[model samples]
Structures are given as C-alpha cells and as structure tokens.
Target: MSDFAIGLCGIGAMFVLMILRMPVGMAMLAVGYFGTVILNGTRSANALLLTETFSSASNYSLTVIPLFVLMGNIASAAGFSSRLYEAAFAWVGWLRGGLASASIVGCAAFSAVSGSSVATAVTIGRVALPEMKRFGYSDALSTGAVAAGGTLGFLIPPSTGFVIYAILTEESIGQLFMAGILPGLLLTAFFMGAIAFVTLRNPGAGPRGEFVPFEERFKALLRAMPLLLVIVVSIGGIYLGIFTPVEAAGVGAGMVALMAGISGNMNREQAVKAVSDTVRTTAMLYLIIIGASVLNPFLALTELPATLGETMTAAGFGPYGLLFLIVLAYLALGMFMDGLAMLVVTIPIFFPIVTAAGFDPIWFGVIAVIVIEMGMITPPVGLNVFVVKSVAEDVSMGTIFRGVLPFWFAMAACLLVIVVFPQIALLIPQAMFR
Candidate 1:
C-alpha cells in the first residue's frame, strides 16, 4: 500500500484505540511506532521511539509545565484563590448579577496563576458558588459564570494550552502568552455582558449583592495583593523582557510556595501533595508530547499535510477561507474531544496548513486556544461544566449547560472580534518586542 494510505489506516486505528478508552498518548505512540515500522523498518522505528522519548523529556521548555502547575497548586493551598474571589466580590457583588460577575473576575485572576481550566473552575466555584447560592442567585447564572470563567485559564497568561501550543508549533511561548492577554480580557467583558443580558431577561435570576463599605473593600483588595504581585512579576516580567517564560514559571512557583508557607495554609502534607500532582500532570503532558513527536515523522513520510494544503490552495481556499473552515472544524471537535488532546493530535496537521496559507503562527495559537475554550464549555465534553456540576451537586448537567450557553456565545463574539481584527491578539506582542 502507498505511504499515504498507510498513514490513513494508522490514524483510523489510533482513533479506534481512543474509542476503546486507551490513553491518548499510548494510542498515538502505538500507532506511530507501528506505522513507521510498516513504512520503514523495525530498526528505524525503534530508534525513533528512544530518541523521541529522551529528547522530549529533556527539553528545557517542558519545565514550565510543572513549575506553573506547582504555582497553581500552592496558591490554591494558600487560599489565594479565595482571597481573589473576595476581592472581586467586594468590588462587583453589589451590582445586578454581580456575584456571578465577581466569579468570572476571580477566575480570570486565578487563571493568571492556574493554567488548567478545570482547576480554575473548581477553585473559584468552591468559593463563589456557595456564596452566590446563599445570596439567592439562580443556579443557571451562578454555574454558567463559573464554567465560562474557568475557560480563561486556557486563554490567560501561564496557560497550559499556550505552553503546549508553543512547544508544538515552535512559536515563542511569551508571544503566545501576550497574544492571549487582550483576547482574554475581551472575552471576560463579553461574559460579563452575558450575565447582564441574562439578568435583564430575568431579574430574579441574579439579585444584587449586599453593598460593602469602602473600608472592607480596600481590606479585601489588600488581602489579595500578594497574589496580584506574583501574577504581575511573573507574567509582566516576561512581557518586559526581564525574564524568559521558564524563569517566570520558576519565580511564580517559588513565590507562591513562600507565601503559602508564611500564611500557614500549605502545610508539609499539602506541599508534598502539590509536588506529587505537579509531577503527575507534567508526566501526562510529556507523554503526549513524546507521542506527537513519534507520530510526526510517520505523518511526514506520508506527506498528507502538504497534500491537504496544496489541495486547499488549488481549490481557491485562501488564508481566511481556509482558516474559517479550520475554526469550524474545531468547534465541532470541541463537542467530543478533550481540548489539549485535540491540540496535540491536530496542530501537527493544521499548523502546517495555516502557516502555509500565510497566517501568523502566534495569531493562530491564540485563535486555536480560544476555540478550545469554547469546547471546554460546549456540550457533552465540556470539562469545565462537569467540574462545576461536581461542585454544585444539586444542579443538573442540563441546567449547567444552559447556564453556560450565553457565555458560549460571548466566546463566539470574542472569536469574531479577533478574526475581524487580528491585531487584538497581535498588538501587545508587537509593541513589547518591536
């Protein structure tokens, strides 16, 4: 059989393994190794496996994943996430649907520290959901806000999605992080507008929160200062060229560890657990990266990406048109696939197509991350939605899904804004580096 035909069969077999509930990394690795053996020889496949595993594991950029994950776990242990929620609540809780808005703001703040969307949702929802419920906020609005806000973890600085994308596409992690900033903030605003729209349609859905005295508000803000400082120095330092992304991750983790120790929030046991979690998460990421590396050469042998790109070009699908189709496919994939897995599996194919069509790789990274965010809150496989349901146990999955619908549109709106004006994603990176 032709190499291209072999590649097609390999992809189909990989999906079959995935459907049988095999781990994503394992499925890819198995398919890739055997596919290479078929196309080349067993000797070549063996060498590729060893080299890919060692090289991907030893890469310096991979360190950022564990460090950032540690920073988040430490911060969560220290109750910094709760402090963030309190500060946001103190400022915005008095408005209509303000508690939900506060949750989004708190999630955004924590996103700067925590890179995982499910972690952000669970952390903030633990603090905000009970408070909103006590204040008579509807389950739909409250859960919806938390689910939507959690997606910011994928878009904001320190994002694991950005890290993985950077590693995959060989783009600058810092540039991708900067590209996400304005779009993240823009999506936050759009989510807030969604809350307002919901409350206006049903005022009882979200009642105004109690007014806080200025003194109390200031005190709340003061309490959250340590977290704010960590976020700024870590992320802002990267933008300012004071530190690389890896350095920033190390600094953020160390600072959070110190703060957690000082506050007596992260005990020895908690610290140990944080480190263990970091290792596990880092291992999972590395396995996926290694699997992708092994798969890439086999795919290259098939020349499928080049063939597809040429086909599109021949069909007169210019950059924008091709991009539109890619985004649409992502939205559909979001319904069934895990977001990070989707990135790991597809960017190898899509990145070449996108860059070949003259799209900026960094810009495409931001756009892809945002669509992945939509998937996190989209139906069926909306991971953040399930995270919220786990927290708000009495709320049905349907209710949570319904609650998040408006915010999903907010995400779509954000996508439209960035597509029409790509500079929204590009502006900061350009100014900082140019």
Candidate 2:
C-alpha cells in the first residue's frame, strides 16, 4: 500500500483504540510505533521512539506546563478564585443582569489564574451560582453564564491550550499568549452582552443584585489585588521581553504559592493537595505531548499533509475557504471529542495546510482556540456543560445545555470578529514584540 494509505490506516487504528476506551496518548503511541516499524524497519522506529521520549522529557519549553499548572492549583487552593469573584461581583452585580454579568467577569478573572475552563467554571460556578439562585436568577442564565465564561480560561494568558498549540506548531508560546489577551477580553465582553440580552428578554430571569456600597467594593477590590497583580506581572513580563514564557510560569507559580503561604490559606493539607493535583495534570499533559511527538514523525514520513494541501488547493479552496472548512470540522467534532484531543490529533494535519495557505500561525491559533471554546459548551459532549452540571447538581444536563446556547452564538460572534479583523488577535503581539 501507499504511504498515504498506511498513514490513513494508522489514524484509523488510533481512533479504534480510542473508541475502545484507550487513553489518547497510548493509542497514538501504539499506532505510531507500529506504523513506523512497518514503514521503516524496527531499528529506525526504536531509535525514533527513544530520541522522541528523551527530547520531549527534557524539553525546556515544557517546563512552563507544570509551573502554570502549579500556579493554578495553588491559586485555587488559596481561595484566589473566590476573591476574584467577589471583586467582580462588587463592581458589576448591581446591573439588570449584573449578577450574571459578574459571573462572566469573575470567570474571566479566575481564568487569568486558572488556565483550565473546567476549573474556571467549577470554581466560579460554586461561588456565583448559589448567589445568583439566591437572588432569584434563572437557572438558564446563571448556568449559561458560568459555562460560557469558563471558555475564557482557554483564551486568557497562562492558557494550557495555547501552550499545547505552541508545542505542536513550534510557534512562540509567548506570542500565542500575547495573541490571546485581546480576544479573551473581547469574548468576555460578548458573554456579558449575552447575559444582558437574556435578562432583557426575561427580566425576572436575572433579578438585580443588591447594591454593594462603595466602601465594600473598595474592600473587595483590595482583597483581589494580589490575584490581579500576579496576572499582570506575569503576562506583562512576557510582553516586555522581561521573562521567557517558562520563566513567567515559574514566577507566577512562586508568587501565588508565596501569597498563599503568607495568608495562611495554604495549610499543610491544602499545599499537598495543590502539589499533587499539579503533578497529575502535568503528567497527563506530558503524555499527550509525547503521543503527539511519536505520531508526528510517522505522519511526516507519509507526506499526507502535502497531498491534502494540494487536493484542497486544486478543489478551489483558498486560504479563507480552507480555514472555514477546518473550523467547521472542529465545531462538529467538539460536540463529541475533548478539545485537547482535537487540538493534538488535528494540528499535525492542519498546521501545514494553514501555513501553506499563507495565513498567520499566531492568528490561526487564536481562531482555533475560539472554535474549540465553542465546542466546550456545545451539546452532547460539551465538557463545560457537564462540569457545570456536576457542580449545580439540581440543574439538569439539558438545562445547562439550554443555558449555554446563547453563549455559543456569542462565541461564534467573537470568532467572526477576530476573523474579520485578524488584528484583534495580532495587534498586541505585533505592537509589543516588534
């Protein structure tokens, strides 16, 4: 059989293993190893495996993953997420759908610290959902806001999604983090707007929050300043060329840990939990990376990317057209597959097509993440929806799905905005880096 056919068969085997409940990383590893042995001999395949494992394990850039994960775990353990919610609520909880809006703001803030959307949703949902329910907010608005807001975790700085994207495409992790800033804020605003629209249509759905006194607001903001400072300093350090992405991750983790210890919030047990969680998450991510690494060499030998690109071009799909198709595929897959899995499995195939079409890799990273965020809330396997449902157990899965519908469109709008004006994603990296 042809190399392309062999590559296709390898991918098919990987999917079959995945469907049979195999881990994504192991499935990829299994297929890639055997496929490489088939295409090349055992000697070459064994050598590739050994070198890839060694290189991936010792990769300096990968140090950022664990550090950032530790920062997020420490932040969660120390109650920084609650302080963020309180600050956001103090400022915005008085508007028509203010509590819901505050939920989005809170999620955005927490996302600045915790780069995982499920963490953002679960963390903020625990705080904001009860408050919204107390104020007679509808389940739909309250749940939807948290679910949608959680997606900001992927777009904001310190994002694991961006880290994985950077590792896959060999793009600058710092530039991708910078690219995420405006788009993250923009999406947050769109979510807030969605809350307003929902509440406007049914004012009773989100009753106004009690007015917080200026003094109280000031106090809340003061309490949240430490969390905000960590975010600003870490991201700002990157933009100013003051810290490499890995260094920034280390600084952020250390700062959050020190603050937690100083405040007496991270006791022996909590500190241990934070460290354990970080290790577990870090291990999972590294496994995925290794799997992708093994799969990448096998795919490169296939030359399938070039063939696919040629086919697309011959079929009259220009850059934009090809991009649309890829985005569409992501939207469809997201309903069933995990976002990280989608990113790792597809980047090897799609990145080449994207670069070959003369599109910007940084810009495309932002766009790809936005679409992935949409998948996080889309029905069936919307990961964020299930996360919210788990936290808000009284709320049915269908209700959470219903709640996230408007926010899904809001995400779509955000995607369109970035696509129409790529500058929104490119502006910061260009201004600061250039």
Q: What lDDT is obtained when candidate 1 is compared to the true structure?
A: 0.92
1-434 per-residue lDDT for model 1 (tens digits): 88888888888898889889888888889998999999898999999999999999999998999999999988997788999999999999999999999999999999999998988999999999999999999999999999999999999989999998998889899999999899999999999999999999999999999999999999999999999999999999999999999999999999999888888987788888888988888888888889889998898898877777788778887889999889998999899778888898889889998988888899999999999999999989898998999999999999999999999999999999999999999999999899
User: Judged by lDDT, which candidate is best?
Assistant: 1
Query: Any runs in candidate 2 off by more than 4 Å, and if so which?
Result: none
Q: What is the C-alpha lDDT of each candidate?
A: 0.92, 0.91
Residue pairs in collision within model 2: none
Q: Can you write out model 2's per-residue Cα lDDT over 1-434, one digit (the tens) per residue?
A: 99999999998898889878888888888888899999998999999899998988899999998998889889988889899989989999999999999999998888877888988898899999999999999898899999999989988988999999999999999999999999999999999889888988999998888899999999999999998999998999999999999999999999999999889987899899989988988888898889889999998899877787789888887789999999998999898878888899888889988998899999999999999999999978899999999999999988889999999999999899899999999999999878
Each candidate structure's count of clashing pairs: 0, 0
Give TM-scores for every candidate, taking all chains together and pairing residue i with residue i: 0.98, 0.98
